[model samples]
Target: MATARDNILKKIKQALVTKVPVPFSTHTETADLFQPSQKELEIEFAEHFTNLQGRFSFCSNQQELTEQLSQLFSSRKWERIYCIDEQIKDSLILNGMNINPYNDLAGCDASITGCELLVARTGSIFLSNTTSSGRTTSVYAPVHICIAKTSQLVYSLEQALLQLTNKYGNHLPSMLSLATGPSRTADIEKTLVVGVHGPKEVYCFLIDE
Candidate 1:
């Protein structure tokens, strides 16, 4: 006797195998989001952060989120910090930590932003680039921190792609960054070095909704 979940999955798989298009455009749009399982994504994200050279931390709520993040900058003695979006900006200001908006991208020691969603399938954070400040704040700084709600965590890349298409309607941006981990390179002797081109550190503050 197949369970309801099993039956649904079986039907979905059959549709995929047969290339049967879903009648609803919305459902059809969500078809290919699978990548890796949730457990796999957690493992991958943990492993990547652990082996990373620079600073890294993950928080599951606003209190610890603020503490860990504030500690990151304070420990590093980062005086000039910039942030994007209202959440981080408000947090910093309320906590008596000064965070300037990204008027000048290249000069900040760290920058923070909120993400649309986190694709657990690939350990990637999707930046809409809907606002110029958010894009540059994430990319240009030496250290980048992103705040995401746990409710925003989706199982697969297909979910993320579907959400983007539905929300933005096709005018996605000139640049869409799917950052899996910190910017890294194996330049000399093929030895991996993190923070080569972009932020040396990518800290995720996962707020539980």
Candidate 2:
């Protein structure tokens, strides 16, 4: 007269008799893990980024950066560039590029911002709301330009997170974006479409100085 629910519960209880808990151990040594040099990291990052259809460039100093910016602006025809970061704004002015106010993010041809970290292992850039650009500028524009220093490059995602944790401690940004490449999707009839939800083009300018 027992209900079907009782039969299922009884069977589950019987199965529990043979169940065993597994023990886990942790290791502290990572000596066997392969660690690449900074130069090697840069090489890997550039290769991976290029494979993902991203544009990558390097600058040794502010002069080179300004020159690169000039050429980039001319090549992309970016008249109104959305930039919120103070440092980036200064750089833009120094480079003689037009800077659009934050209010006109949607109308701008491209956006330039500073990133928290660049993951060399995956060629990804990490951003946070805590940055000067907040969060909208990076994703709202049709073309996104990220400026990062060579020192900001990390070997892998784990190292990036560890560094962030060490730097921020308990205070972390409300949002973090780990952008790998330009927005792309093949949702409609398996046709590849770019910039459907975000920037169609992404450029990373790595400054050595």
Candidate 3:
């Protein structure tokens, strides 16, 4: 007597021999999976980012960014904001932010860094190891504050990757990360927990370029 598996295999082989019309044969490969949005890229990014629980802010200029940072710091009483990027540090210092050199990361309340590209479609922040901030600065901190420019925003992941390739040529960074929002994982007991592995709060300051 044949086994149940043999019967299933025989049926599958017979079905394979019976050819049918291909589903949606007229559909082109270039066809978009999602409908095109009328909203601006900035607005779309902000909407998706906020929906992902990311704190999004649009700054008219660098001065506005400074002011917003000051307000946020003051309101949150955040004292230890660790920054490894020299340019960002200079900007903050020039803006009159009291930043003391932090040797221990344990005392750090937040971290400020720059990202490679901001994906408008997914509201993801694409990051590479090119910046002085390195890898640890963004993730180790409880709160991550990313200072991005409007010029860095791209429509999709493919666009971002293409730009990255053009920017870096053959010598790409060893690691590339796309941070969608504040890091969270629902692993243990299926209970959604925030900041268990990475940042609890993610703030993106998009400055007009």
lDDT of 3 by residue, 1-209 (tens): 99999999999999999999999875545555555488888998999999999999999988889899989999999888888888988997887776787755657988889999999999999987765278787788999999999999888787788799999999999888989899988898899888988899999999999
Q: Which whole-number lDDT from 0 to 100 does residue 156 have in model 1?
A: 66
Estimate TM-scores for all models. 0.69, 0.80, 0.82
lDDT of each: 0.69, 0.83, 0.87
Give lDDT: candidate 3, residue 29. 56
Q: Which candidate is the best by lDDT?
A: 3
Of the two candidates 1 and 2, the one with more favorable TM-score, higher being better, is: 2
lDDT of 2 by residue, 36-120 (tens): 6657777888887878878899888767877888788889787787887887788767766555565588898888889899888
Query: Candidate 1, residues 94-124: lDDT per residue as tens digits?
Result: 8665555555568888777777777664567
Candidate 1: clashing residue pairs, number: 1
TM-score of 3: 0.82
